[model samples]
Target: MTTPGLAGFIASGEDSQTCDVVVAEVLEALGQGFELLPERGAPRGGRRRTWFDTFDWRLYRAGLTLEYAAAHRGGELRLTGASPYGDAVQLVTGWKASRPHQLRDLPDGPIATSVSGVVAPRALLPEVTVTGTTAAYRLLNEDGKTVARLLVEYPAVAAGDVRPLPPRLTITEVRGYLTQARRAARIIAGIPGVWPVTQPLLADALHAIGRYPGDYSNKVAANITGRMPAAEAAATILLRLLDIVEANVPGVLRDIDIEFLHDLRVSVRRSRSALKLFGDALTAPLAAPGTALTGRKLARFAAEFKWVGDLTTPTRDLDVHLLDFEDTVRTLRAAKPDDLEPFRAYLKQRRVREFRLLARGLRSPRFVTLTRDWRERLTAIRDSANAGTAATVRSGQSRRAVVETTGTLAADRTRLAFAKVAKRGAAITPASPHDSLHDLRKRCKELRYALEFFAPLYPADSYGAVLADLKRLQDCLGEFQDTEVQIGEIRALATSMLAADEAPAVTLLAMGEVTAWLAARQQGAREDFERRFAEFAGVDGQRRMAELLRGGAA
Candidate 1:
């Protein structure tokens, strides 16, 4: 989606040198009935302006923009709605040592209150920087009343070196003069060698610097097709997952927010699942004396990824507890939320220690090797698949006969995964042990992950129906397991706090009430499991899964 802004015109054929010519033509054209009056004391000299967003473009995606200007009108940090004509909430701090990193860094006022919901925890890193000079003119109608504001920009992007950008003309709407503003825009847009700007100036500047807004995302977006070779498809998914892992490393290291570590762990978990489920695709012959390199690499990388996953767990667990601390306390019938302040302090202290280790592990030589070598290996696998496809084309062999495609592999793996879930689920009785339900939950998760991995191979409607059924079952199982874990963790925390002499008798009593609350939740989830699983393995769900399997096979 394009960023919202005023009706803007960018030079289509003219460079910055000849851009002034277009502006001249615009003025001459408007001379017919409209008059251009320069705003007195409007700066003609350029000032540096920097746009900031989360690495994932959280602000931009939310239809908001935040910028700091060195001297545009006056030095200030401004946050505005998407529309260029929208009123801006500004904090006037003329020439500071540094810009605010997160919304909390801004003073508590309209601007801070506005963005607090959007950009908390996530640091607002600068995405693009540009220097531009603007000449502002008021477009007046027949009675000499200003109907619109026109800005002529001479801009350059600051990347490695100063890169001149195409000059732009923007017509901002004046309040109570919508028709005249539209007429003025039409006149400016019709000028030769200019076209209406499709995106914000930030996009243009980012392009000049070889960066883009909203380029980073945590989700896997690999484009896989049924006809693609299994190894290539697996590699494509792994490579995409790897990108997510890498993209989040900086944020993880900085400890910017809980999500960076959360996303990184999720990618690692998915990569492990893909490797185990698609192991056959990676079974290449021996490379060195008596050693199969592909298998060896797979095993080694999987172990390393597991280690990396383990490293982040401690900190992530503590993060979760702290994040949910307020809500968890609210569930207590007798204890006020503040009664658990000691417990909150203990969680924070543990998190700081755990996070130090996490950061160290991420920066270690072992992790460096894992990311670097894993990328190279995945690339080689993808290239090998491409080469095999080329050979099959040349020799006139059927694509399926020469290499395993996603169609065959997805069907085979998904069938096995589904059968595993069905078999385990069928064995569960109302009187079954919690361990039995936990084991079945594991199988359900595996099946869900397999469906997610190969979703591109099936029709969206069929896939969605099947996944919805599986997700209902999975959610029930997840809730049951999570509550049980939370109960255990709370007990452990109580013990540790007592041993450390940190927990008073009152704090322990509060924790006991919280534990009772969690036990009730776990029992509720356990009771609901039977119904959720019945729906998951019900006739309609089974039919959808069969259709999905057939679609993949076909």
Candidate 2:
């Protein structure tokens, strides 16, 4: 019943006392049905191993693991499944670098291509590194075909001070040899002082270094409850948002990748959205002297976050521009992409300047004060709710605890947001001004954020259905807005370039052509908006939204 490719830890005492006897017992347990054969040139000792994953553990979440190992001869990269059953595809890359932070740093090959596909735009950071000596043996059946493989590893943490870890035995099942692999695993488990490993060895190694995989994530994961105080719920979400914002700051400063800044800005924006949607929910009176922590008090922090968003916008916009430049070039009507090289150069230069400003702002005392004060305030609100502090609504009505629960508050907010979206969307006519569509887009975004924030308080199916409809509508709005913004930005950039004497005649013409194409795209989005809105506002979608609202109340 043992899982193939299962790993077990061997007690140090038993391993040291009966190392040879343990191997003999495994061989004997095979009962001559299988023969043990030592693999030729197996690494007995002194191989450096490093485990790679994104900061968010993207590969681990995707059920894959990437490992780089170097020996006296060369290095090899292996991409393996993280399942109990071993599955691996490897490339024998020979010592490309000490460490590659990004996919581009990896040599061109299948491994690199596969990794790039998974961890797009995120840096592949070394999660754990260890020096281990492994002895490999193959289990062969009577037909002389390998049925299973076993690796006995003696690993130590590869840090400043060497710390030895427990020895492990890994039973790797060959394809179509599940029975043989299970037998090997059973024999190993039966051995005295050997215990099955619940987690992977990489997790163990990471623990030695006081780290764990998937420590950072950009998603909002507030565990809000139906009966929980709204203030506490809001604080929980804001605190998590702050954590995301702070975690991404180091990556942003290091310029590790563009995603860091993007994630940070998104966290800040989401924090602001939470503040807006949860405004009524955050009415719990604080234990502080006199004044309550109302929207007025939070207004300052909201402004500070707005500054953070504005500070990061320039760099992020340019990043989007450069990232989409190739596709834009391909869509051009007249000028060659090469003609836009000067404009691209200008964008890069502007990005560097904007990034410098951004870094300075982030490192400034204002940011430090904002984060620290924000955390303290939010924590105080959470503690006040925990203490069950009395609060009053702004209209001077005594607050009822039931009405102030996360579920009730979320339901009220969701209804209001949906109503706003419905009103704005219904008002839009085919001949309505572009500004009208833009205004409705903002309303749709607010509704989308409300649903997402309070999703845990509603039924999954209902929430999902409503969200899917909204997302479809949002996609159309997003495409339309993006093209509109790009058109304006291109025009502005063209003017600036001309002013700076940086734009050649060809580049100006190319910019004009790209702007025209973007306008056409925007027109197409505008034309298709009615259908997407109709689907979002359809009877089925409305029913789901109603059900979601009722579910939250329940």
Candidate 3:
């Protein structure tokens, strides 16, 4: 998708230097009926505008932008917005640092609507900042009434840098004046080095400074091929994941965003899943000596990673409650909503305390030892493997081949996971215990993570169908589990809050209502499970899985 704004413009032959010439020609073309007003010193000058997004650059990826120009500009502001992906529109909003930067800072309006739709509760960390000078002009009709406006933007080398960069022109079409706006566009289109560009000025400035979006994602994906050694692939995957864990630790400690810890936990879980899916293959002899871990050693590392996953669960689970508390309260009695505030306070208190403990665990000497050992282990993997008969069978290749590559083994591992999930799913009957569903959820999750780790090895089209089916099944199971957990947490929270005198009967009633609502949702999920599972295990899904497992044109 082409970016919709200035980048979307067809460059006219004249550059910014000659833009004035185009304006002169345009004024001439308009004859004596139009007036070209003198330049006004725009109130927008001298302010350093900074843009922000989540760590993953989520807003930019979703074709949205959020910026907080500083209070340094000092007043109400007018914005001309454009994107290569959408419409160019105008907005008026305020910028002040009354609190930490958040989407809520904007008054209720289109700009706020655009931002909240994207960033939501996520923190708006500074992505980039640029200082620019603004020059404004008014386009007047023959009656001396302004029908359109123009602003020329000159970005500096950096915030407050004296050297001025090339300028960009912004034309604001006054509402109900399409004809005059089109005429202005025609004149501007005729200039060189000056045309509409959709890329945001902040983005353009960042690009000029060699920065970029999507610099981080909550998930880490690696490219693995069928020709690679299993041990080699394991090293490649683990090392990348290890970096993710380390990178997220700081953010997790800062508690800037819940996803930092969520993603950190996911990486740890994916590590454990790799070990289970690969089993003995992780310890298979590489073509070189000391290049692979023994199964016993691999098992120990998986256990440690599991420990890491365990430490983050409670806090994250509670974070989920607080994050959803507003929505959850909406379904309860109006007065009961404020009654839940104390519960929220309790959750936040627990979260902060638990997060500190988590930070301490991560900072401990033992955790350091485990990570150091794991990093050393990555260096031991061989570039290629000489799979014996034992490794051969585990790899799911033709037994006659007598050898297997890590890439081939990766597909085999994914197949084993799918088979396990399929077997588990097929075994569940309506009479099965709640624990059975929980077990199925865990197994299905492991399978899903394994597929993600091995996805690059398969044809995306074929793999995607199977993945979608698996995800649907996972979601069904997930809704069941999350609601159950939430219900339990809410009850326990109510009891604790009451014991602490946070509230009395009102809190208890609120908890009861919330719990009942969750139970109803959980019951609905339970009823939906059979049909969702059937569709997932149906003929079409089976065919996709078969194609994925048998190795299509990956």
List the candidates' TM-scores in order. Answer: 0.87, 0.86, 0.75
Task: State the lDDT of candidate 2 residue by residue for 1-554, as single tens digits.
Answer: 22445666553433443654565555566545578888898858887888888878888888889888875666777788753435544545454434447767677756776667779878887777888788888888889999888787878888777766777777887888888788777777777656777777788888888987776778786888887777888888888889999998998998988898999998998888877787555655554543247667778878899999999999999999998888888987678889999999999999999999999999999999999988987887787775553443444654453347787888888899888888889889988888888888878877887777777888888888888888989889989999999999999999899899999999999999999998888889988898998888867768778888999988
Candidate order by TM-score, decreasing, is: 1, 2, 3
Model 3 C-alpha lDDT per residue in residues 473-521, reported as the tens digit of each score: 8888999999998988888887777788876676677778888889999
lDDT of 1 by residue, 232-288 (tens): 888888899999999899889988778889889989988888877886686653122
lDDT computed for candidate 1: 0.81
Q: How many collisions between residues are there in candidate 2?
A: 0
* Residue pairs with backbone overlap in model 1: none
Report, for all candidates in order, the number of backbone clashes: 0, 0, 24
The superposed Cα distance between candidate 2 and the true structure at residue 373, in angstroms, equals 0.6
Alpha-carbon RMSD to native, per candidate:
4.1, 5.1, 7.0
Which runs of model 2 end up more than 4 angstroms from their true locations? 1-43, 82-100, 135-150, 159-163, 171-185, 210-212, 286-292, 389-403
Better of 1 and 3 by TM-score: 1
- Those runs of model 3 whose alpha carbons end farther than 4 Å from true positions after fitting are 1-47, 71-100, 132-204, 207-210, 333-335, 379-403, 498-503, 552-554
* Top-TM-score candidate index: 1
